[model samples]
Target: MDEPEPERKVNGMKSIFEEEIKKIQDEIDIFKSGSPNHIAIISEPYSRVEHIYNRILGDNSQKINNIQIFNPVKDTDFFSNFYSNQDIIMMQNCQYLFSRKCCGFAILEEFLDILFSSNKMYITGWNKFAWNYLKEISNIESMFQEIITVPELNSKTIMNLIMSDVSDKVTFIDDRVSEDKKFICFEECLIRMPLSNKEVNISEIKFNFNALKRKKNNKTMEDIQKEAFMDITTLAGGKYDVARKIWKKSLKDGEVRLSRIPQPSEVEISDIDELFILGNILAMDGIDFDELSSIVKNDSLLKQKLYNLVNKGLIEDSDRFYKIYPEAVNSVIDELEKNRMVW
Candidate 1:
C-alpha cells in the first residue's frame, strides 16, 4: 500500500466526463441566459470528479464561455469574494466543507441559501452517498433546480471506456471461475427470522434458484476479456476506478483469471463504535485521520478501530484521509441504516 498511485495514463481511455458534457449543455445555456438553475452533479467516489470539473472548463462548445471555475477544496474564502460580475461558480468537492456535526445538517445551510437567492448559476459536484444524507437531514436537494448523476456503466460501456488501457498489454491466456464454488442447498441458503408479531428476528434472503443454471457459451479470447471486463465492472458497480483496480488485480502471468476478481473483505463487527465511525465517514465521503481522532471521544480506541478497518479492507486511507471503496458503499450504507446511525 506504500506505493503511490500512478496517474491514470492509459491511451484511448474515454474520460467519464465526455459523455455527460452535452447532456447538461442546455441547462448550462439556460443558466447563462439568466434563468436561475443550480446544477448538482453527484457520483460515486473514484468517479474522476476533478477530471469532470476540468472537462467543463476545457470543453469550448458547452456554451458557458469564459467563466472562472472556482474550486473550494482549499479556499474557503472563494465564495466570500464573489461579485455580480461572476455569473457562474463551479463548486467542486463540496464534501470537504462538511463534517458529522449535527448529523451534517449544519454544513452548507447558509451558503446554499445564498446560492439559491442569487442570480448566479452554481454548478456543484458531490459524492452520491453524502448528497443523499444531506438531502435527508438538511433537505438540501430541493435547493438545486437540476441534478445529474454520472451514469453507472454496464459491461459494454465499461469496455468502450477503459478497454484501451489494458488492450495489447496483456493477452488472455486461460479462462477461470470463482475461487470457491459449491452447490448451495436451497434449505440451507434460505434465511428466515420470526415476524415482528413474535419475539424474533425475521430476515429472509431469497435466491434466484433458476438463474443458477450455467449456460454453454463458447467465446473467443477477445470475447472472454470483454466478459471479464464486464464482470469486474458489474461487481464494482460500474465504478471506473474500482473496476480498473479489480482488473489489475485479476491479471496474473500476463493473463486474466475470473477467480482473481476482488470483493470487500468481510469483518466481524462486535462493537458498535466501529459502525458509528464508518457511518460518519460515509456521510462525509471521506475524513482525515487527525480530524476523526479529534472527533472520537477515545483517541487510542479510534486509532485501533481505524487500523482494523484498513487491514480488513472495508476502508482505505491515503495521506491520513480515509474513504470507503466504491463497491462497498451500498453495504456500508445498509450497515449504517440498520444500526440507526443514519435516518
Candidate 2:
C-alpha cells in the first residue's frame, strides 16, 4: 500500500508532464493549421523564410503553393504561368513581388497597389527595409485585409511602424516563438467584431496592458542589439560576415594553413559544444554578452566543455576570450550535427 502511494504520485507527475506535452503538441497543430490563406513574410535577402517554409511543410505535412516573385512581372509569361497554375491550393496565388534582389519601399508600394486593385489573396516576403517603407505610407496599410509581420531585427523605426498599424482593421500576428517558427496572435479584429461596447472596452483595456509589456520587452531587446552593433553600420561591422566566410573557406580549403599548424605541445582538443557557442559569437561580432545570454542560455553548457578542451591543447583562447582551437572547432561542429543539436 505504501509503494502504491509512491506509484500514484509518480503517475500524477507523469500526467502533468503529459499534459504539458499535449499542450505543446496542440500549439504545434495550431501553427501548422492556423497559417492563413495568405501571408506576407517581410524578410531580408538571407532571412529565415526558407526555415519557416520548411517548418510549416515538414512538421505539419502541409505544402505551400508558392509563386516566387523576385522582380515585378518582368516576363508576363512568368507571372501568367504562376497565377494560372492551380496546383497551389493552400497558397492560391503566392508571389515573390520584388523588383530586384534588394528592392526598397517604392517597389513594395507598387506591390500593395497591385494587391489593392485585386481581390485575390497572396503570400509575399519582404525585408525589414521594405516593411518600414510600407509602414510609413498609410495608403499602403489600408490595402491588406490582414497583415502578419515577422520581426527579423529590432529597429526603432520598425517597432514604431508595428505599433502604428497593429489595429482593429488589421490582425497583427507576431511570429516570434520558442520552438521552431510560431505565429503569436497580437490583434484579431474578427474576434471583437460582434462584441458589445462594455465587452469591447474591457478587452481593449486588458489588451492595452499586455501590449505595453510586450512593447517594453521588445524594445529592450532591440536596444540592446543596437548597442552591440553600434560600430558596424552594416551590422557589428562587415568584418563579422567576412570573417565567417574566411573561416568556412579555410575549413573547406582541403589543406590546413602552414600558419595554422600548431606545435604538438600547443595542439589540444577543446569541447565540441564550445564550437557552436563560439561559432555563433563569431557569426555576428559586437553583440553584447548579456543580450546573447538572454537569447542563447540553452547553449551555455558549451562553455564548460570548451574550458576542458583548452587544457587538452586542442584549442587556444584569445586575449578577448574567443576560442581559436582549430581541431576542436571542427570536432564540435561534427558532434553537434551527429547529436542533432542544430534546429
Candidate 3:
C-alpha cells in the first residue's frame, strides 16, 4: 500500500472551486454554532478530495485547534484515545468500513456508530462508487447533512494543468480553423509501446476528464468512437486523473502525438462462470484478489481469470486489489450485459 500522502501536498496548495469551498465553510460554520449538520465529501478515486479538506483546514485551523483527522482504513489509535474536546473530526477513507462478503462491517460497526453519533462536526471523505453502493444498500447517504462531490474538469482547465508540466515539448498546433469547422492539433512523434517492438505514430491532446463516456442527447452508444473534441475536453470525459495518466504514458519518447483515441476493449470470457465472475467484480466496484478468490472458491480458476483480465488491459492490479481499468469500465459493463452475465 502507498504511504500516507505528505501533508504539504494537501495543505491548501491545490486550486479548488471557490463557491464549493464557501458552501463547505458555511456548513462548518453552522455546525460550530450548535446546529445539527454533518458533511460527507465524496470524490472519484484519485481525484482532488484532500485539496478540499486542506482548503477547509487552511481557513479554520486557527479557530479550531481541537480538530483532528483520522484514517479509518489505517489508523489504529482512533478509538482508544478519543477525546471529548475534539470538536471536529475529519476521517478519510470511510469506505473501508463496509465489506462485500464480510461479517457485519468487519468489526467497524462500533467505530462508525460512535463516530456518527458524536456531537462533533464530522467531515468524512469517501470513494464515490463505494458511497453510491452504500447509499443504495444501506441508505448511508442519509447520515450526512451535506454532501460534496469533486468537480469534473473542463478541457480548458485540463490544457492549463498539462501544458504547465510539459510545455517545453508540446505545441498546440491548429490544423484548420473556419466558421464551419475548427480543429486543434498537437505535435506528433513515434513511440514504441512498452514490451513491444512496433513503433506507432501518435499525437497527444489534453481533453476534459468528464467527457470520457458521456453521451450526447439522442445519440446511441456506438461501438466505434468518432474523433471529436468539445471545448477541448471531449475525449477525457472530464476526469483529469485519466487524462494525466494518458499524458504520462505518452511522454516516454519525448512527447508522442496522441494519434489514436483508446478503442473499446473486447476482453474474452472463457466460460459462463468466468463471465459471471467478471460481472460480479465490476458490479462490486472492485474487489481484493483474496476476496474474489474466496468467492470463486477455486485457486487455479481465479488465478487464470485474473491473469487473462490483466493481460488484456481490462483489469488493473494495485496493491493486490483489482478493478477494471477506468478506460475499460464502461466497455466491460456493456460487454457483460450483452453476454447476459449480469442483469
Candidate 4:
C-alpha cells in the first residue's frame, strides 16, 4: 500500500525579522570597523523587540562573542553589574529606564550619561512611542548613531511568514455570499460646497477592486489564499505577531476562512485618566500594577478604572501586568495620538 499523505494542519510560526536582522548586523559590522556610534532598533509596542534582539545574537553568535545583554524591569538599579570587558552591550526594553511620573528621569539621565561616556558599542531596542517621547524631552536621539525603525510587513511577507511553519498543505475557503462580499460600499463624509463654505454630509461610494476581481473571474485556489491572507494582514495592520494571532484564530480544520478573521471593536475613550493610562502602558509596552500605580497615583479609583478598561476589551491583565490587548493595539495608538498623549 502507498504511504498515507500527511494530515493538513496549521502550525504555530516562528517570528521572522529578516530585514531587521540584516540592518542590525550591518550596523554591527560598521561598529566592528572602528565606528564610535551606537545602534538603536525602534518598533511598535506589540512588535516585541526582544525577539529581534535574540535573533541577532543567535544569527551572529561567533561574530558577537563578547556581548552583554540587559533587560531592565524598574526605573533604577537594574544596571549595577555591567560588564566592563565586553565590547558590545545589548539592552532590550530601554523604555523601562524611566517612568512617566515626577522625578522619573533620574534613572534615564544616569543611563544616558553612562551610554555617552562609555567607549563600548551599544545596541539598544526601544518602544517607538517611548523613543519619540524621550527624543522630545531629552537628547536621547542624538546618542544613537544608527536608528533603525522596523517597518510593517506587507501582505505577501505576512503570508510567507505564517505559512513557513506549516508541515502540511492547507486550504483557503471563501465562504461569504455575494451580498456579504459586496464590491461597492457607501461611506459617509463631510464635504464643503464649491460656492458656499458650508459642510454637507454625503455618501461616497467606494469600490473594492480585489473583491470585484474575485467576483469577475473564476475563483482559483490561489485567489482564495490571497484573499484570506489579505484579510488577516489588514486586520493585523501588517504586524507579525498580530497577523499570527489572527491566522491561528481564522484557521479551522486546516481551512483558513476570510470571514473568520477577527476585528477589534470600536473603543471610545472620553476620560482623560483612561487615555493616559492606556498611553503609559503602551509606551512601556507592559507595566506591572505597582509601577502603573506609581505613575497614575489614583489609589481610590485605580482599581475601578482598570476594571473598566479590561471590561471594555481595550486592555488585558496578565499576572498583574497590564498591557494593551493585542487586537486593540492599533486602536489604542490612534486614540493616544489623537489625545496628544503619545507621539
Q: Top lDDT: which candidate number? A: 4
Check candidate 4 and list the clashing pairs: none
TM-score of each: 0.73, 0.30, 0.64, 0.81
Model 2 ranges with Cα > 4 A deviation: 1-37, 59-63, 70-72, 75-77, 82-121, 145-343
Candidate 3 lDDT, 101-174, residue by residue in tens: 53535435666576567766777777665566667667567778888877777665665565555546542222
C-alpha lDDT of all candidate models, in order: 0.65, 0.36, 0.59, 0.76
Off by over 4 Å in 1: 1-12, 15-19, 60-78, 102-107, 167-169, 177-217, 263-270, 325-334, 337-343
lDDT of 2 by residue, 239-336 (tens): 22222333233232332232332222322224445545544432222123333343345545545654655666444555434433433333433444
In candidate 1, which residue pairs get closer than 3 Å at backbone N, Cα or C atoms, i.e. clash?
A: 193-202
- Ranking the candidates on TM-score from highest down gives 4, 1, 3, 2
What digit string (tens of lDDT, one per residue) describes model 4 on residues 190-307? 9999989899999999987878776678878898898888887777777877888878888889888767877555667999988988888898888888888888888767788888
Candidate 3's TM-score: 0.64
Which one wins by TM-score: 1 or 4?
A: 4
**Evaluation by TM-score, superior candidate among 2 and 4:** 4
Model 4 per-residue lDDT at 201? 97
| Reference-based lDDT, residue 299, model 4 | 71
lDDT of 3 at 152: 75
